[model samples]
Target: MPRIDWRSDSGSAVAEFSMVAGLLTLLTLAVVQLGLGLLVRNTVLDAAAEGARHAALADSSLPAGEQLTKQLIATAIGEQYAADVSASYGTWHGQPCTQITVTTTLPLIGLIGVQHGLEVTGHAAREVLD
Candidate 1:
């Protein structure tokens, strides 16, 4: 090989590595954020369903269901996520049912996101004494 000029590209590798590393870091963070959002959503949904089932019992009341839902959410994530929980008596498929609704924030960046961005509801058939 004729006169090789190695000095011309001495710092080029560092510059290229920096650019690629930055992009990879951002992509990693985005994936982690998405996973967190999904986890929170699933947790909230499960809590609401459990609450509705509990409230559907003959001896349980709507307020009790709401409290259970709030407690479950607070235990899973944070107290703020447990806010805005409501339970109501309604009809589902023409049968009496207990419904629990949870409205909370959608986590985007480390458990901080748009308020009221996510809403989930759970329903269970009500138990009646013959």
Candidate 2:
């Protein structure tokens, strides 16, 4: 009769799987978190660009642009996401232009997770008189 080394290899696969499964779970969560952060950033950036374009019109005011930026962000994302929005005018290539900057928190585990973690800006040139 041959005796088996039950304690040596039995359930080794299960043990290894448990350890690897935890790491995989964490890696998956990290990717999801990164993706969410990027999505939020792109959304804010697009909103800022849209706001800048709206304000760059010959008939638009800086304040109007700022308001539009906030509204666009809030509508697309959330009101909290547009809490810190600003509009400014500056020169680009020696040409006058409107720049909209949106500074917002980055979501770590969820929205409102990180404080002052990320920032993005958008710009557009006003219609120049010919």
Candidate 3:
């Protein structure tokens, strides 16, 4: 019997690519999703910290305090992403603290909706001045 020539097969490359492409695509999407999640989480944390800092100031107004937190995040992220930001102010350890929570969803074709989605939370605190 003669040895089979694998390279001569017409569908071999297509089949191989089809299998590997799906896995690679999925991996790329996962990485992107993770990066986005981390970025959003950090933004939320920073916003909260800035808000608390403003609130701790001697002459800071409530609306200005809220705007400072929202604006900081809006500058880092764009308007589309900025809309989801929400913050609440409170006291912790005698310090003014702001808890910022940001949430968004990503599309996942293979997983449909479960694994593709993510939720991130962050908190920050600052000492309140008399």
Where does candidate 2 clash, by residue pair?
Answer: none
Q: Write the per-residue lDDT of candidate 1 for residues 1-130, one digit (tens) a residue.
A: 6997876977799999999999999999999999999999999999999999999999989999999999999999999999999999999999999999999999989998999999999999999999
- Select the stronger candidate by TM-score from 1 and 3: 1
TM-score of predicted structure 3: 0.61
lDDT of each: 0.96, 0.88, 0.60
RMSD of each: 3.1, 2.4, 5.4
lDDT of 2 by residue, 1-130 (tens): 9998867877799989999999999999999888988899999999999898988998888889889999988998799888888888998788899999888889988675776677888889888657
lDDT of 2: 0.88
Off by over 4 Å in 2: 1-7
Q: Lowest lDDT 10-mer window, candidate 2?
A: 110-119
Q: How many residue pairs clash in model 3?
A: 0
Candidate number that wins on TM-score, 2 or 3? 2
Q: Write the per-residue lDDT of candidate 3 for residues 33-74, one digit (tens) a residue.
A: 777666655775667566655655556644555577668767
- Candidate 1 collision pairs: none
